[model samples]
Target: MNTPDVAGATGYIDTNFKGKAEKAIQELNDGCDFVYIHFEAPDECGHRRETQNKIRSIELIDELVLPVVIEGLEKFVDYKIMILPDHPTPIKTATHASDAVPYVIYHKNAEIVSGIDSIDEESAKSTNNYVNFGPDIMKKFLGA
Candidate 1:
């Protein structure tokens, strides 16, 4: 998958994803329990002022990046993958919206969570580990 030229950034999403994936694989091999991979393409496309590009970026991530991450994840005995956008960036406004976007938590052990989509705002908010949105969210995500 190819990413359109993203101005004011050092590299595009696909390139950065490749580099980040390698590091994440190494870290996972070293026995880290959790790993977070953020796909910046959709957000970048929003800033670039194109709805098609943003849509394509999300498709590309699912087609190209996700499979790669899933392969690496299989190396772990048991793992959970949480996929969520930090915030919504409307292509029209080209700015982030303070809204709750749906989050997905995929488990290698499917029995832990429902197979079908059962996760939602209320469930996530009431879960044992409820993380309020903010700068600190990254800290919670990284387990630092």
Candidate 2:
């Protein structure tokens, strides 16, 4: 519900990413049980075939966003974080691909045994864990 106009050179980092992270942290501090933060820069860069920008966007998410969010989540005793893309947008094709996207579920209190250290398509597929239907992932993520 807090969509900002991210339509310029620095829009990816300033508005779409850092701003979204700040808003999510605010919502968490406000006692919201669930907060969904989405960054559109990587997808947008892929669509535009800006390969370097796409890499930079992902880097910004890791450097500028995730650390802040993790710090915010540390204030709580228990929390879960799910990170994933809705679909693949290949820079070469500049279009959406049907390939299954990668996802990672991190439970603060659980001791996960999965050896997957990276959250990328290859690592996800290597685990052979997949939700055949995309919508079903929500139910699984929520433990419903």
C-alpha TM-scores of all predictions? 0.65, 0.88
Predicted model with the maximum TM-score = 2
User: Residues 100-130, candidate 2, lDDT per residue (tens digit)?
Assistant: 9899888888848799888999999999998
Least lDDT summed over 10 consecutive residues: which range in candidate 1?
1-10
TM-score of 2: 0.88
lDDT of candidate 2 vs native? 0.81
In model 2, which regions exceed 4 Å deviation? 1-16
Collision pairs in model 1 = none
The window of 10 residues in a row where model 2 has the poorest summed lDDT is 2-11
Query: What is the alpha-carbon lDDT for the whole of candidate 1?
Result: 0.64
RMSD of each: 6.6, 2.8
Clashing pairs in 2: none
